[model samples]
Target: MQTSSNTRCCIVGGGPAGMMLGLLLARAGVAVTVLEKHGDFLRDFRGDTVHPSTLDILSELGLKKRFDALPQHRVTGIEGLFADGIHALGDFRGLKPFPYMALVPQWDLLTLLADEAERYPNFTLRMRCEATELIRREDTGRVAGVITHTPEGPLHIGADLVIGCDGRHSRLRNAAGLRPRDLGSPMDVLWFRLPRHATDPDGTYGVPGRGTLLVLLNRTDYWQIACVIPKGGAAQLRERPIAEFQARIARRVDFLGDRVNSIASWDDIKLLEVRVDRLPQWHCPGLLLIGDAAHAMSPIGGVGINLAIQDAVAAANLLAPVLLAPGLPDEATLAAVQQRRLLPTKIIQAIQIFLQRRIIARVLAAHDDGKLVALPGAARFLLRFRLIRSIPARVFGVGFRREHIDSP
Candidate 1:
C-alpha cells in the first residue's frame, strides 16, 4: 500500500544543500521534509573541506561552538612543491576570523545540521527514502510532489514546493527534464588512505611534479591521498600490477617512504570520475534545483561543498517568504534563486577550466616529452608574497558571492 504525506516544501536529497535549506526553512517556521536515500551519512572520501565561508555561516546560525566541538583537522594554507622547493601558495590566515579550513568528515557536518533541524517541530527527515519520480499536476503540469520508494512501500509526498538538492547524479533533475550542460574536465582521481606516522607531514600539501599531481591530506592517524590521473586513465593504470601503481606514487611523493605498501591491491583504491556541468535553467513551475543539481564543480579547490551550502542559503533566503505567504511560488521566484547563484557557479567553473587546460593539461603532456616545467615566474612571484597569497586564499577558502544566513 502507498502512503501519502504533505508539506510546504519537500527537499529531495539530504546532502549539504538539502540539510542546510531544511534547517533554514524550518527555522522560518515552514513545514519542511527532507528525504535521504541513505540511512546514515557515513560515506567515505566525500568532500570534507569546510571553508571559511561555511565557517562564517555556522557562526551566523549560532552553531559555531557545536561545530568547533566536532573532530577535525585544520589546514591553515595551501602549499605546493616545485622543482625549486616547497612554496606557500594560499594562506588562509589572511581571511581573518574564520582564518583556516576545517577538514571535518562530511558525515559529522550532515549530522550536526540534521540534529539542529530536527529541533524545529516543523522539520522532518526521512531516511532510506528514495525519490523515484516527480508527481506533476494533471491540469497545470507543474510538479506537485514526489513519489518515493521506502522500505515499507511506495509513498507519495505532496508539497507546495519541490526543491531538488540531490547531487550530481540527481534523479530529480532528470525527472524534471532538466539537463546540465557538460563543460568538461581532463582528469579523474584515485583516492586511498595510508597510515600516518609521527614523522609524516603535519598539514595537507600538494606535490606537482613530472606528469603527476598528488595531494596528501593530513588526517591525524591516516593520510587520505588523492592521485590525479588523466581522464579515463584509471583502467589503463590498473592494467599494470598494483605494485607499479604504488611505485609511481612513491616516486612522486617520496615522503610516503615504505608506507605505500598499505595499498596491497587495487581494491584499496577508489576511482572518482570527475565532471563539471550546470543546468541551463534551474527551475520549472513548482520545482527548483539547487546545489549539484544546478551545477557540478570540478574538484580543483575543494569548493564543491562550499558552493552547495551557499546555494542552500541563497535558496532559503529567496524562497522562504514566498513559500510561507502565497499560493505556490511562481516560476519567476524560482528563477530568482538561480539568478543569484548562477554567476558564482559560472566564475568558479571558469577558473577550474582555466587551470585544467593551462596548467594541468600542459603538465600532463610532459608524460610524452618527459619534461615538466616549473610554475611560471610571475605566478610564482604572486604566490610567494604574503599579501598576494590571499588572492588564491580568498578564491578557494572564502569563494565568490559567499551567502549569509538570511532566512531568519
Candidate 2:
C-alpha cells in the first residue's frame, strides 16, 4: 500500500456527479481530489442527454458559452411515433435561455468539467485510479479514506469526507454496506448506431411497435438506436442470426429503409440491463453517495445523467460551507444532502416504474398489428391537455427542484 495523502474531500468515480461536486468544492476553496478509473473519457454509447436543468447549471457557472460550442444535437421537442402518426411529448418552444435539451457526447461533457476544475488550485484529478475499498476510522467507525489501485500499485487516500459518485455498480457503496433496493424493471435495451442521412427523421424520436419500443436519438452524423426488449431477452436474441435483428428492426421502423443493417454483428450491439433502484441510506458519518451510486435510473426519460448532476449540485451546496471552514462533514450535513435530494429521486423513479409496468411491458407483449396500440388513459389525458404537456417537459428537463450555486 502506498502512503496516505490527505485532502479535505475525496471523490470516487469521475462521472458527471463526481466531477461536478469536485469542481464546485474546489471553487469554494475546499481541497478536492477526483479519482477516475479510466485514463481518458472516450467511452461511446453512454448517456449523452444534457437536460435544460443542467444547461441552467452551466449558465449559472458561466460555462454555457463553452458548453454550447461543443458538437451537440438540440431537441426542441421529443416526439413519439405510433403506427399511424406522431405524438408530441416535450415541447420546449417558449422556455427561456435554452428552449431545448442538448445531446452532446458524455465524454465531452466530462472533459469540459475536468478542464474547468483544473483551473482551481485546490482541485486534483487522478486518472486511471480505481477506488477499491472504503477506509473506516477505527475509533468512530466512520469512513475516513479510500484505498485505490493505480498503475504503480495500491494507494491510500485519506480525507475528512469521502463521496461515492462511482456510478450504479459503485464499490464504495457496497463497502459502506449501502444496499440499493431494486425497484424491478421489465425491459432492457440494445443500443447500436447507424449513419444519419439528410432524408432521415430529425430530432429525438421514439416509435412504439407491437411487442417492442424503438427509440432513435439523432447524432449529427449517425443515429443512436435503442431497442427495448423484455428483461433477460438479450441472451435469446443473440441465439438467433445477426441478420434477423436487422430485418425485424427495419420492418418495424418503416422510415429507416434498411439502414438498420448497419449493425454488422453481435459485437456492434451493446446491451444495457435496465435497473431502477435507490439506496435507503445514502451516507454513513464521513461517507456519502451521490448520483447513480445512490439511485440507478431507467432510461425512459434519458434523465439519469441530469439527475446525477443535480445531486452533485445539491451536495456541493450543502457540504461546501462545512468543508471551507476546515471541518469534517457531520451527520447532519450528510443527512441534509439526502433529505433534500431523496424526494426528487423517489418521484422520478416512481414515474419510471409506473411507465415500465403500465406501458413498456404491455407494449413488449403486444402482438404485431398495423394499428398502433392505444396509450393508457392517464397518458392520453396528460398528452391531451395543452397545459399538462409541459409538465413532462418540466419534469424531464428541469426536475422537481432545481438546486442553486450556493457554494462560493
Best by lDDT: 1
The TM-scores, one per candidate, come to 0.97, 0.96
Which lDDT values do the candidates have, in the order given? 0.89, 0.89
lDDT of 1 by residue, 143-200 (tens): 9999999999999999999999889999999998989999999989999999998987
Regions more than 4 Å wrong, model 1 = 368-378
Candidate 2 local lDDT, 12-119, one digit each (tens): 999999999999999999999999999998997888999889999999998999998999999988888765467776677656667888989999999999999999
- Positional deviation of residue 167's Cα in model 1 after best superposition, in angstroms: 0.8
- Clash totals for all models, in order? 0, 0
Whose TM-score is greatest here?
1
